[model samples]
Target: MTTGDAVRNRLGLGRLLPLGVATDGAWLTEEAAVLVLRTAVQRLPAVTLGRVRVSLADPAEAAAPTVPPPPSALPPGALRIEADFTAPADRPLPTVASELRELLWSTATHGLDLVIEETDLGVSGLSDAPAGPAGHPREKDMTAARPPGGRPAQPQGPAALAASAAPGVAHLASTLGDPVHLASDHIRVEVATAAGHRPLAVVGAVRESVRGALGNDGRPVVVLVTAVGTAEQPAEG
Candidate 1:
């Protein structure tokens, strides 16, 4: 494969963190979450971010979300955000680090609606000058976002229609096969979220919409958020 292809491959999502509690929650892609996080961090003064990653703080004690993550997502639980940053040498280092830590914590919890447990910080570089506007959100190509095993979205009758029509949902997806999967005990759908909405909120709306459309069949409705659209990348029809 080409070098760009290889790099892009690595950019594909790592672990899908749970958005809510074990009873009712949604899975969010690391890349999608990072896009929101990076944007928020860039607003900080005298700080330039380095590598950033999010994962379960303690997988051993993590509880799986109400809806188990698909094969593409990580096991559910409280997660953490760890990153390397450059602080201004002129300012008090502790203060700068504290600001960075608060920003990470607030963005992950309040902004992204993630169930984050920790925010680990490390010093990577020091700068005397103020931070510049070189910060750009991750260029994640989420046009093809879908459930891990799902391919492109396919016509799944009324069920697919209901899922797409839900608020905050961009569209239905599957990395490999049809977007909607039907089983004896449950129904699963992977979706890309619409811009300007929380991924977890979108997931909840979708679950409700699909559930209503399908009626009470004793088969639970499952929704997975595979991709989230940014302001620059508005969701498609």
Candidate 2:
């Protein structure tokens, strides 16, 4: 019998989903993806977002990911956000849907820097409150979060430390033992990131840091993002 973790990993419902492409990619957990999108949608007047999710837009695509995602983690490819929401009572449904579609698109693409191909919203109910002016999502702060500087690390102790010390890394999320997995051919690092930082870039930086610590070996380095912390205040630009 398959364990729950295996099922969750395969489905990747609440796990990390691809933020960019499979070859050079990063990930944002589905939970965090939903929170970011839902927060953006909540700004829309009279709209109540619920059950937001992110997933591969084309599930049939056969692009196997290079980075091995954690158990209960997402695979690779272009992603989409699917949401259930409460429609404003006074507005025409079609107009409201169109407005929402654009908001989600902009929020996912511009705000979160996600490779979002589609924004699909379904009306679960109608809000009884009167409609008001539409609200836009808060723009993500693009200011760089500097990585911790120090002497170059070596071997496992420093490799893990270097990766953990990398920018946007909140913590290491390895399931058991060390977060740095040294296989016969490659290395894998799992991390939880801070919100507001771009996921793709963060992962790339992490891979670089880890690789550098490992003597810049020819072997490929895989970085998997397991979680993303929520931004406390929306730093609208």
Candidate 3:
């Protein structure tokens, strides 16, 4: 198989739903695609993403025909994405928007290998600086304790659930500041280690800690410990 096929196979790409009958390849789910793009945009300097939406430009056009077309006949630009965000007010509005547009375009076309017909970016507001990607309040602490007489809110989605569980796992593993990447089915954490610490022991501790913390959430969790003694790093795509 070719390199692309190999990569797709490794990623379980065959399971994804196809964009249309014409395209032989499948496309990532709208949620996953949005997450990928949102993460990329959130990382851009001075940009704070507020809301994101991803969908087809023409739902009717994307609807599959009775007879599936051949792979060679697929049309391009099948997907459309919309994002609302704030950027530094000091930067020229057009310049900032253009940069943001280019970043989104490159990430979709190159990183995700997905064709996007359009990226509609709206400058909803301006922020002085970029917001922390890990600044989700739920991830800050996972204790059952809450303000007296106040009930804890339920986690309504995969992302929120993962964020809620991350802090407890981090605390138990003694890597309270490490990065956590959460998906619907899995959670990958980076655990820290020291010169005298046992590498296997640390990994085992982290696994047990997060597993216990998560406590039968129905999602299979995967906890990964970073290489021993590596400096803390941000989550990467």
Candidate 4:
């Protein structure tokens, strides 16, 4: 299905708001945060935002809210906001790709640089058994000639099985083996400035864009963003 249809089918957000922006040391109410996350995921089928939990790093500086309010209950003024869009663990990866495409389009409109880090979609483990006893019962003579295992004598170890099984095993290994459970499609965006950027607004825009792109079959998309200059630096070698 198209992006819009997918978002509508998967998530049911009616009216979306414009982009929301926030900065460090800001105070965003819980309700507003959820709204942003909900809207974004609704649009991006590949993205599935789960339960959101907000906390104040410094209770003394900024006290925590006893009961989090809905998106509408967000208090005026900004504080550093960290919004996490938790993806569905069970959904397939292709669906996520469609949603991410939409998110990128939206962020582009606002002159933001969007980057996606895809999770590794690889097979972790595998087990296979030889085809159970190939011939029918009447083939007693052939069976008798075979080993006690009642199956063809397949070779064991790399030297014996390399020529026969290498190609299949290589293909399977490349496709399914990933040690790190990285997201197949991880997305990140960087807005030039946090001035006009509201967390809720950016997320909402992303959501709407994804929904518009992926329609009914939109997959779960995961997105994260930061200001242009605030990105964390890697450790020095």
Candidate 5:
């Protein structure tokens, strides 16, 4: 059956009499339920059912601006964009991390190499336990806690990672903290760059390329420019 029909049938609202049920303020008919489902489904964009990817790259030196420039003076390559944070996992912690890994793999732009590095989870969640053996009660109840299973639970086929990641991909894009536009399923990042083959210029080019590839509409997109390098490095002037 069609999706709408399926929804209607499931709700038991397919084609009964509306008025019969409504004498005392009758209930909706099966047909009305089907219609409602159809309308609701139709309202969602087609892109919502499929995966969309956005790419990001570090900004080139010329693109890194110490001071803001006039809109007219801005070059096209100043925006470094990445589609990292598309969605946040509804589940907490380890599950979220696992979901993030899947999302990164699934939503990565085709032809780009992407990998998830093991991040330092830090001591925040750690706990002290009684110094004891395997079955000791003092052992923090590890039974209730577990890390997200490794890559195996990822979406499962060749692009399983990407597929699993698709649900939460928007979260990755949010980290960029810049204005972005989404059209259809594509995302666009706006940026400015400078002339010449300097480090800043190269960075800007990278930024622009990512912005172009990751452009999306109807979804959140992240545009990150390499505002500044590591703390030890001097600020661009």
Candidate 6:
């Protein structure tokens, strides 16, 4: 490893070029933020992280001059954090998602000192378990601006459909222990298994849950079984 590699590993902040002038000094890297986010999500119950993606607003967007000027020409650390996770079916999905969102939002805002523009939670699967308490799940209301075409714009974001899928499936099978990756309308799930568990069965279950949460919108959902461990030693998410 060279000096550049070491610096890049420690502070994954990318090159800063403003009007062809390169700026010096290290900023927070996406990897650093992801580490913080993953650790935080792991601490939550039934919330296993599959994947984490972070997007920072363009610095040029803030550089534009306006009346009275924006809040300091210094680039603001605006962040949009998205994650794919699996939770036990027994636990309320909305509640789990809400807690995770608050946890990440606080971690980004207070711990990392970054501005959280949006934190989208994508539930990739549920661990298999017994039936949950009987009750109709609360409906989520999403309003969108209608375009000139007159068709109401559809709701976007992973959190939009979590509630509907919570009660349908029992807890997800534990074998699908790996993390998930989701962005826009795409979902990629990584499943881990043991010698006794059937990988295909687990993947099918996860796919069903994903379909339930996302609906049959024709979006692509990819599930990959990445690891198989012995019964004594299980794979990690």
**Residue 14 displacement in candidate 6 (angstroms):** 7.9
Pitting candidate 1 against candidate 3, the one with the higher TM-score is 1
Off by over 4 Å in 2: 1-15, 72-74, 131-156, 174-178, 229-237
Best by lDDT: 1
Q: How far does residue 36 in candidate 5 sit from its true spot (Å)?
A: 54
Q: What is the C-alpha lDDT of each candidate?
A: 0.69, 0.66, 0.45, 0.28, 0.25, 0.44
Off by over 4 Å in 6: 1-26, 57-60, 64-77, 129-237
Model 5: per-residue Cα lDDT over 59-167, one tens digit each? 2422332322212122222111122222222334455335434433332111111121221221123213222222222222222222111112212222222222332
Question: What TM-score goes with each of the models?
Answer: 0.77, 0.74, 0.43, 0.21, 0.16, 0.40
lDDT score for candidate 4 against the true structure: 0.28
**Which of candidates 1 and 4 reaches a greater TM-score?**
1
124-233 per-residue lDDT for model 6 (tens digits): 99976443333222122011111111112222344223311322221211111223445465554433333333333444555666667766665455443323222221
Which candidate leads in TM-score?
Answer: 1
Model 6: colliding residue pairs: 50-179, 50-180, 126-172, 127-171, 127-172, 128-171, 128-172, 128-173, 129-171
What lDDT does candidate 5 reach at residue 155?
26
Q: Which ranking of candidates, highest TM-score first?
A: 1, 2, 3, 6, 4, 5
Residue 135 Cα positional deviation in candidate 5, in Å, after optimal superposition: 53
lDDT, candidate 2, residue 179? Answer: 74
The runs of at least 3 residues in candidate 4 whose Cα sits more than 4 Å from the true structure, single-residue gaps closed, are 1-26, 57-237
Question: By lDDT, is 5 or 6 better?
Answer: 6
